[model samples]
Target: MKLENMVRKVYPNLMPYVCQLADLPIEEMKQALGKEQVYKLSFNENPLGPSPKAVKAMQEALLQLNLYPSSTGDALLARIGDKEGVEAKNVILSNGADEMIILVAQTFLEPEDEVIIPEVSFVQYLASTHMMGAKPVFSPMKEDLGVDLDAIIERITPATKTVFLCNPNNPTGTVIPADELRAFLKRVPENVLVVIDEAYHEYADDPEYLSSVEFVKTYKNVFVIRTFSKIYSLAAARIGYGIGQEELIEAIHHVRPPFNVNSIAQAGALASLDDEQHVSESRRINQFGRKLLAELFDELGMKYLKSATNFVCVDTGRDSGYMFDQLAKHGVIVRNLAGYGMTTSLRVSIGQPEEMQAFAAAMREILEKEEK
Candidate 1:
């Protein structure tokens, strides 16, 4: 008997998420490039690093490694509730935003259900829906690469169980305007769940950008997901949470694993909330780096999205795979969008001034060589 036959039917058809340059080991890449320093802008990691308070808290938490974390994450949950202005009962903690997406699927999706997903949004939304053997209805993004609310609305049917929205969406970094989002939410059927992933919420400074957390307070179907991984620089820690109606949160708890979040991560995330200065500084620097990259792209005559997040997606006018390889050889790593079907675009994370300068120099060198 083939052991593979025993696996779930959906497992064989599902495509694994391709992480591009993020899959390459940084140390190995540095060694291969023969450089002591390599600028990694593939993953949208905080250039400032984790907050000092969070680091100190995690260090102190290390003393209790022998014990398990609070299964309920009571203290951390309370802190999150205070931060988000929601009751503790309305929040659900997960290992990461990815896991939160999975939990939502597990709790709500059935084999016959359909999940509406943006064609170019986060891969986890599609992955999670497939994991539950649910059909995913791909909604095409607008010409500007922004989520098309009306398109999603038009696609909804009786079988539609959930709609995934990524504000300041990954790769594209474009946000759903406040008024449009409000109208869309009102138009969506209350029976269908709407999952809004706001992993880059803290980075968005546009006045028109509205957080979906407020919607959660009034709409029973609205669920807002957030993470410490982005702004808090706790990507390795894998701390994320979801906010929704109390009943919806309770439903998710049924599928949540015991002690899912580790003590160190909880401590780091909890302390990170109090470090307002670090958050402010990170935001300021991100704005500066984003502007720098946008200016560089403009000078290069490249078409790029106007980003409200910590990354920019730019068309390279050449194969993204070639651009990725050339940049990697120059000790600079960026995300190639070939896997996402954007053959000529690359998503580059905003890094520190010196790191961005290195990337700028590498781009000039590569383009000059190509011209020659």
Candidate 2:
């Protein structure tokens, strides 16, 4: 007679996503720590905030709130096509990159299929695979914490349906180089799909880092997913899209939800794409912040990874869970990477100049006290 019991029987062993342990809301953190303000450097959000152009567009679009959004997101599609030089038919917009990941799993995965992902990569890859009752094959990362193309290729088998590659991978911001990817893609089985998740593409400045958008034109099995949430500062808007060959895109759209991208999100995303000035400014700020954080970490005698995205992974040489609490008390909130199997490191998002300074001060105070 219990609904919970019945639901559990029907959907047994559903693996829930383990999201990054983000900071509490600023006001909430202030209350908890008895601080005036708390510097939040947890989720890799843009420190500059959303684009002014996108904000204005969303404001104006509110007048038409009563109407439903364009289910297919044609305007946003055209903008993406123009920017990426792909046709509208090749793009499938979603609520965010999150939906894109789920859509791919739903559209392609069979109960007996397998999805190959980096061992410590995005949690959604495993969660989505489990959601579809597919097997998740985790390929271990390389020494530098980048995707091990060789290991992933070795894991491919007859049951491998898709491979999820999070370029400028979350938690650890390392990227797969263009040459390495080209070689790996060549070796991948033709039947298996390769998904390139570029949620933080705009922040990637490495000369060797390549966008997988071009691969879509050459490979039928290649799908490139992008989100406006990062550098565009449209995280709350939840607008993202997947780009692939026309046939693949058409198939995914068949499984997509109606009006998945709401009106405000579509309007904001479209405006964000056109605001190149804002993009440049965001990149500038991110680059500056990244450099500043790296320098600070070096000065603190901490080990950290060189990041391609708008966040730095720092090793605090102490229990990261304890470190995180101490940081909170010092009015700084950063992501504890223990969930990512990293107990001594924290993933800190690149914040504004003042926020970074505050983080540096707090980190110094805690670490120095620990040393004493």
Candidate 3:
């Protein structure tokens, strides 16, 4: 009897994550192209880098490398609770927002249950649902590229266990209006969980946009998932948190592993919270970069979606894969949306001022050559 033949029949072989072309390692691309300078604008990472306070804290935390991290991550939870106006008991921190997504699936989903997500949104929602053998229902976005709350609401059935909404949605960078969200929440069944993934929360300053944390207080089934990876520039630290009712959070805790969030991440996240100046500066850079990119696109006569997040999705009027390769040769990297079914579109992250300028110059050269 072969060991491979003895595997569980119901378990499906999972496919490896297929990343966007722009997300491939810059160093590898640089080596291939023989280019020295690489501008990474594919991951929506903070251009200014990590908070100074966070860097200092992580460096000092090296002294405790021999010791185990705090299992509860209580101090960081307290800071998050204070900032989000939620009780520490109602918050669950994870290695990253990605971990939180898996935790929710492990806690709430069962075989045959339905999980709703936007068609062009985060890939994790589908991956988590598949991991649990749950059915994933993709609701298509509206004409303007925003989440169609009405479509999502109409698709909900008793089998629907979770609905993941990415505010200032990824790839597209469009947001669901506060009024629309409030209306949608009211229509959601109490048993169905509503997950609001606000990974780019710090970048969104639109007057009509509402933070989902406020709903965690009023609704038992709502969870607001946030991360330090964005504005805090703590992507490498892998720290994020989810806010929900105390009972909901307790259920997730039951499935959480001990010391799931490391001490260094906890230290970095806590210190980053206190660094308001850094947060403000990151926001300023993102806002300026977004504006600059938009203007560049306008000058080039390229069509682009107005962005509320650090990235903008633009129609390049050519095959994105070819364009991605072209940009890589020029030492400029950006996200190719071919995997998202937008073959002619590319998602570009706002970088430092000089890097954005470089991207603009590279893009102009690429487009001009295509014309000739």
Alpha carbon lDDT of each predicted model: 0.93, 0.89, 0.90
- lDDT per residue for candidate 1 within 1-372, as digits (tens), equals 786888898986678665445566678767777888899898899999999999999999999999999887889899999988999999888998999999999999999999999999998998899999999999999988999999999999999999999998997999999999999999999999999999999999888899999999989999999999999999999999999999999999999998899999999999999999999999999999989998899989999998999999999999999999999888899998887899999999999999899999999999999888
Backbone Cα, N, C clashes tallied per candidate: 0, 0, 0
Q: Give the candidate number with the greatest lDDT.
A: 1
What does the lDDT read for residue 175 in candidate 3?
84
Clashing residue pairs, backbone N/CA/C < 3 A, model 3: none
Off by over 4 Å in 3: 1-13, 18-21
Choose 2 or 3, whichever is better by TM-score: 3
Between candidates 1 and 3, the one scoring higher on lDDT is 1
Per-residue lDDT, model 3, residue 42, is 93
Model 2 misplacement above 4 A: 2-5, 8-12, 15-23, 32-34
Give the per-residue lDDT of model 2 (tens digit) for 299-363. 98899988999999888888999999888888788988888788899999999999999998988
Query: Worst 10-residue stretch by lDDT in candidate 2?
Result: 15-24
Residue 154, candidate 2: alpha-carbon lDDT: 92
Model 1 misplacement above 4 A: 15-20, 32-34
Stronger candidate by lDDT (2 vs 3): 3
